[model samples]
Target: MENKNIIITGTSRGIGFELALQFADAGHQVLAISRKMPKSLMEHSNITCLSIDISDENEMEQVEKFVKDSWSNKVDVLINNAGLLVNKPFEQLTTSDFEQVYKVNVFAVAALTQVCIPFMKKGSHVVTISSMGGIQGSMKFPGLAAYSSSKGAVITLFELLAEEYKESGIAFNVLALGAVNTEMLQEAFPGYEAPLSAKEMANYIFDFSLNGNKYYNGKVLQVSSTTP
Candidate 1:
């Protein structure tokens, strides 16, 4: 495969971090965005680390400018991997909690995609990382009302976008991930061992982001070996 310009959010750690490294190792030019910058990502010659809160409009504009100025207004792949999860019971969850989770998980995905679409051409793929909890009829979890609902919202959002942009040939898809042994997972399910590690899940996402579009568009693939 030819080297392509890729943008991935939430690269500070976990699956996002692994994805950044994997893409860079594969000779892709990567723009890694996260609220916190990891030194390892910065040290990579093939990766550019941007420390910014994706929920902030100003910070998102900076990403647009960087793409326009540095990437020659071209983006081959965009991975919306940043997510915020608030583990609180529905009764205890405050409005602020919902806003915070939605800001990062749902709104930020839409905001970043809106800005990057113009730079993408035919064959470009936009992959949004979601959670299995978001899928209807899937096993529901407690204390994930905000997080799971936000994930579900993005799934529908991208499905709509895929159809709207079908003529443009830019593929949009969502991957509803199951339990992965990441920090986030630890927070949600303490002491429960996940069958998959961060690196393992990242490898799957890395390959899907590159080639899944050829077979699917506006589709949600449940990428889990076990139920959450």
Candidate 2:
């Protein structure tokens, strides 16, 4: 494949950083957006790490400006991987928890997409990462009601967007992945061991974000191990 312009959120570490590294290694220019730019991502010539919190609605304008001014007003692949996971039972969750989680997981995805889609054209791809917990009975965990629900909202947003932008030839997809060994997963489930590592999950996610839309758009792909 030819070199493509890519944008990824939550690139400070874990799957997001791994995805950026994988893409940069393959010669693609990646705009890595996170709260802070780590030296790991900064060292890559093909990677430009933007320090911005996607959850903050106002910060999205910075991304738009950077894309237009620095990288030209063109983006081939947009990945919404930044998310907030608030682990709490439905009964203990307050409205504030819902607001915070939804802001990062759902609203941020929608906001960033809105800002970036203007620069994208036909053949562009948008991939938003969701979780298996978002799917009913997919990961039967006690806590995380708010987090799971927020992820579900992300899946719905992209599904509608795919239909609305089908004529534009822009593909939109959701990857409802199972637990991966990341700090976020560890925080959510203290001692539970995830079946997949961040690197393994990043390989799958990076590939799908790059090419899975060739066959279909607006599909929520459930990625998990066969064994429970």
Candidate 3:
């Protein structure tokens, strides 16, 4: 993976940060995009941090252009790892919450993937960060409709993208995480315990990215602490 150009979103912190560091440690040139860059990551030699909001259309265009021009229009791997969550009853959930969640989780992924398709070479991979709530109904939780539905849509997007790009040699998949001890989770469910660390989740994603196969493409992987 040395010299490979990898692009990841939401790298300011949490799982995205861990993934960026892991790839950089492995000698890959990383382009980390987020709204902000942590001071600790400013000194990473292998990483180039770009501050851009994925939810903004114009910013996304600029990011796409910068990536293409700087990287010679080539991206080895693209990871759509940015997401949002809102908790409240249906009646209490405002319209802005729905729009914001969908914009970040669903719209951004679709737009970025579409723009990245032409830049990706054969054997390149795209990974989306989804949630286990995407697979099953989250009746136990309140006000998860917007988030869960967006994840479900993300899974569907990956399915269509995998089939559409089958001959193109660009693999696409979604990692449906159970509970990662990330800020997003903490913000959504305060006091949640026994969650996976960003490094643990990053490792899982790293392995999958290296070993992506036909069977995994378009498939939603439900990651949890206990599995059969």
Per-candidate TM-scores read 0.99, 0.96, 0.93
Judge candidate 2 against the unseen true structure and give its global Cα lDDT, from 0 to 1: 0.88
Name the regions of candidate 2 deviating beyond 4 angstroms: 226-228
Best by TM-score: 1
- At residue 26, candidate 3 shows an lDDT of 88
All candidates: CA RMSD (Å): 0.6, 1.4, 2.1
Choose the strongest candidate by lDDT: 1
In candidate 3, which residue pairs get closer than 3 Å at backbone N, Cα or C atoms, i.e. clash? none
**Per-residue lDDT of model 1, residues 36-104, tens digit only:** 988989999999988999999778988999998999999999999999989988999999999999999
The lDDT for every candidate, in the order shown, is 0.95, 0.88, 0.84
- Per-structure clash totals for the candidates: 0, 0, 0
TM-score of candidate 3 relative to the true fold: 0.93
